[model samples]
Target chain A: MLSVNRINTYRIPFTFEYYRPRTLREALEILRSVEGAKVVAGGTDLVVDMKFRRVEPKALVDVSKLEELRYVRLVEDYVEIGSAVTLQELVESEVVRARLPLLWEAVNSMASWQVRNIATIGGNICNASPAADTAPPLLAYGAKLLLTSLDGVREVGIGEFFVGPKRSIIRPDEVLQAIRVPVHPAGYGWSFRKVSRTSFDIAKISVAVLLKVDGGRIRDPRIALGAVAPTPVRARSTERAIESLSLEEALEVGPRFVEGDIAPIDDVRSTAWYRREVAKVLLRDSLRTAYERSLNPGWVHEG
Target chain B: MRVRLRVNGSWVEVDVEPHETLLNVLRDRLRIRSVKYGCGIGECGSCTVLLNGRPVTSCLVLAAGLDGTSIETADYLAKTELGTRIVNALLLEGAIQCGYCIPGFLVTIYAALKSGMIRRGDSTEIARAISGNICRCTGYINIVKAVRRVVAELVAIGAD
Candidate 1:
């Protein structure tokens, strides 16, 4: 028999309420009425944190049953992903793999298959961990977050949605409804690299690079880094430095520029010095790989 | 909270704490002791069960969330002909060992087999499908052998 820990009884702070809302309107009403209500999608991250007493909300509004927030569609120039969609769904989605391969790559490299089955993209973004796997790719893809509350709907850039570690601009009453990823035209190349102790370890440092090249000169470039800052950040300095550089010159200068932009901390996963060094390495490698794949489209593999 | 679920083709209703894990509810409330609790977390696959035809870690699944869902435990394996063949092969091949992890292994393999995830006559596919499950005693040699035997039987019976 497994050793059962003695159950401890604490005085009820108050009888917290649990509400299961099946529709978007019902969910919004519950979130608007409850003072400290939380929206539970897959409960992969929330329930674990609650069990450890890290988070205690007055009410939990289960939104896993909301079918409206569980789809992936390509509309106009963007691929809109519903917030309640599971990581597993994203990883296995044929449309996601076809249109947004980098997003598929990042999601596949996250927690094991079982966790992916229950972890939702919205929960991942809402949890707002600095090491979130989906953020860098989404940011690189120029994704827009769609948030909804009883008041109305609002959209925010993925980069601006995250304010700090374990924090976002989302209000207590607002729930993330969808992620809109702008579709890059053909010939745009992308790469995502996550360095960790093991394949399953939370990213020590992750880098995403997107490049579009025309006639061997950079047409457009975007770079994002995670786990090396308070929030996943676009490396504007590094991106600007390589904006006009040739593919060869960009390869040489990208790492040096990236090394100067990040502010990493020494944590249990890695030291500041190591993270910075790996950040440079990953940035250079991902840039080179993305550039090569962009110029040679046939080399890119579909996930 | 009182939750009702279809377990192994039978309706089971039990009252459980809102926070109680599905693993706890299965073993404690339903007396489905076959689902062992190893590592209480999802890391160890000893508490695996089929939820709506997919193998999921029952430890991380809350009982409240499983209301009205179809759950399959190891005890149900004997009801199907293919399941009985696999179970018989396991016994004949001496894959039992400590037996604590057998139930989860059985359920995981059953789901994999029924889903056509592990095609007949493919031992590598069978091994990869059940790689999530950890068996401390068997060292997996006999377990793989038993699975291979079942694969062969499945091929001969045209049950692919």
Candidate 2:
């Protein structure tokens, strides 16, 4: 149900100690020391979970205040984005807009501007929601995560990050430090589309695609979908089906293979049957747009 | 925990619980009525407020996490020059109905007008700027008109 129908309680029913550390190191130490501590940056997801008693941690280690964890830069070969960087910041950044248009599209299509002001990429990924809009783009981009703990730092690809609903591979003591997406060549094209009940509603189905057309042949195509499976996933079979075909042929046959990659189920927003049907349309349309954008780089995204 | 906020151009210190949201802190503790609590979740922009010149839902913001931050609510903004212009624009266009969502809308509009979020009077651009605020009344036609007027006025004065 939409939140406008019902009013939530005035305050969080359960209480927890809140720790806002000054530095990334201090935040990690607090996360390691506190029992059942959770990392909170924007609180868009965690606060709601805590309010509904869906998740109750003993303490909260806030990383939003850490200056070191708020950055968006293009390193030698990858886009280095701090985990604590807010979605609005990412949306407004010129570096991200030009370098990762699909990510910008995904973030721009997310929750209202009010929510985007404080929502962080790390929280969106960590929440691990099946309908997370950010997940599909990250998965298509083959993004990587840097999870840090007292022991050391470990990197995990975004495709293997989420295990199930509201669950991830992140350890209790580890904090997601940064997200890195390898910079693709200049000729790569991308597309992102999300169909929600309303303009501001959560996605019922979403699709993201990235590929390059070399001499009429689609190469290195990556396709990802959301709200269709237990986790936002890469459509491996669909990618393989369109590997050597022309964009016109891929548009006709790629969408058919998408059914084999996703396992949809009935939910409040949509049903498995409906999702299975809409998935084909979403893929076909995105493949067409991706093909168009691949041919025209200047018009990757229109204002 | 205790924190200080520069709210509506005034600095005040308030003691708040660790789990207390900014919505509760502003309404229950500080007696700021402009910030409404329509939804405890982030979906409803009824709890919208300007934190550091950016619009954010107060319900999802932890009061304990914000210290020495600047907050601007509709209550204080209604008295400012920009706020007065926005209210007048809405009034001239007859944009208010039951008015439950106006406060949040006003804050969002004021923030958008003050920033470069809406550079032109385009309906789609203005609609995206105010998408956070939900008005049950008036189909947002007059609201968009009001913003368009403000955008034109700002453009004429070279203020934006």
Candidate 3:
């Protein structure tokens, strides 16, 4: 039984030291040395959870103060987005807006502008929610997660990062350092669609598509869906179905392929049946829109 | 834990628990009740305050984490000339009903006006700027009227 004396309505029971390290090495060392410590980047997610009694960490290592981790750099063949970079920063960045427009689109459709100002890209991915807005677009872009620990740093494919809903392959002592996305060729066109109960609410079903097309024949296609399964998933079957088809034919077959790819569950916001149906509809619409834009980039400005 | 911050243009030193929120520190310790605790969560903008000149929900912000940051609450605006004009307009327009949400609305609009995001005499821009704050009283008609009146006054002063 939970102890009544141990619980406080206004504060947490346990008191631990709070450390705001100036450097990444100092922060990582504190995280490794302190037991049950949580790394706080932006604190948009962790602080809310802590206030609501959802998560209680023994110590909080504030990583937002580390200026070195807050950067967006374009390397040789990939764009490296530091984990501490805020969603608003990512959305407004000329590099991200010009190079990765799909990510910008996804970031724009996320929570309100005020929330996005403080919510970090790393927090969204680290939270590991299936409905995370940034995941589907990043996965579709073939991004890789950079994880660092006291031992060493390693990269993992974004698709394989999530083990389940609200769970990831990241170790307790490891932190997400950065996300590296391979630069796409100039001809790639992308689109992101989200179906939510309200414009600002969480998504019921979302879809992202990145395709390289020449005269309506698909050269390469990538599709990812969110809020339909326990984790964001690539609809490879849907990609295969529309690989050799024209834009119009692909739209017709896209819904059928998506219907078979996702397994949704009934939740408070929506039922499994409604989610599946919307997933199919969004997948079809997103593919059609992406294909049309790829054929004629000028269509984006037309109404 | 002890956290010292600049509040309402004044440096305040307060000792708060590790789990204390900025809202708690502002109201309980500093005795600035203007920032109300309606929801005790980020959903309600009642606890909104300006952290480094950007509007953020204070209930979600940790007081310990806000060290070395500047915070501005609705009360700080009462000292400004533009703020005085807007308050008078709000009172004249009967925009205050229960007065629970007035502080949040005032702080948000003050920041928006000071930022020059909404030009003087632009009602639509003012409305869009304050869209994030929800007010349950006066049906928002009088609130819009109050903002427009203040904006018109500011524009007239600029002409002077």
- Please report the candidate that would top lDDT against the real structure: 2
Separate DockQ for every predicted complex: 0.28, 0.86, 0.42
Question: What local lDDT does model 1 show for residue A160?
Answer: 92
How do these models rank on lDDT, best leading? 2, 1, 3
Error of 3 at B149 (Å): 5.6
TM-score for each candidate, following the candidate numbering: 0.87, 0.97, 0.89
Query: Could you give candidate 1's per-residue lDDT for residues B1-160 as a string of tens digits?
Result: 7788998898988886666778878888889888888866565678888888778778777677667899888888756887798899899999998888888888877877787767754666776567668898988888888888887888887765
Task: State the lDDT of candidate 1 residue by residue for A1-303, as single tens digits.
Answer: 555654221111223567767689998898888898888877767666665567777788878768999999999889999998988789778888878888887887887555666779999999998899899999888899999988888999998999988999999888899999987658988899999875656899999888898888886798999999989889999999999788789878888888777889999999999999999889888988888879876554444
What are the fnat scores of the candidates, in the order listed? 0.05, 0.88, 0.27
Put down candidate 2 lDDT per residue, B60-143, tens digits, no spaces. Answer: 999998899999999889889888988999999999998888999999999888787878779888999898888888999999
Give one clash count per candidate, in the order shown: 0, 0, 0
Q: DockQ for the candidate 1 complex?
A: 0.28
Instruction: Choose the strongest candidate by DockQ.
Output: 2
Task: Give RMSD to native, each candidate.
Answer: 3.7, 2.1, 3.8
Candidate with the greatest TM-score versus the true structure = 2
True contacts kept of 3: 0.27
In model 1 chain B, the worst 10-residue window by lDDT is: B120-129
In model 1, pairs of residues that clash are: none
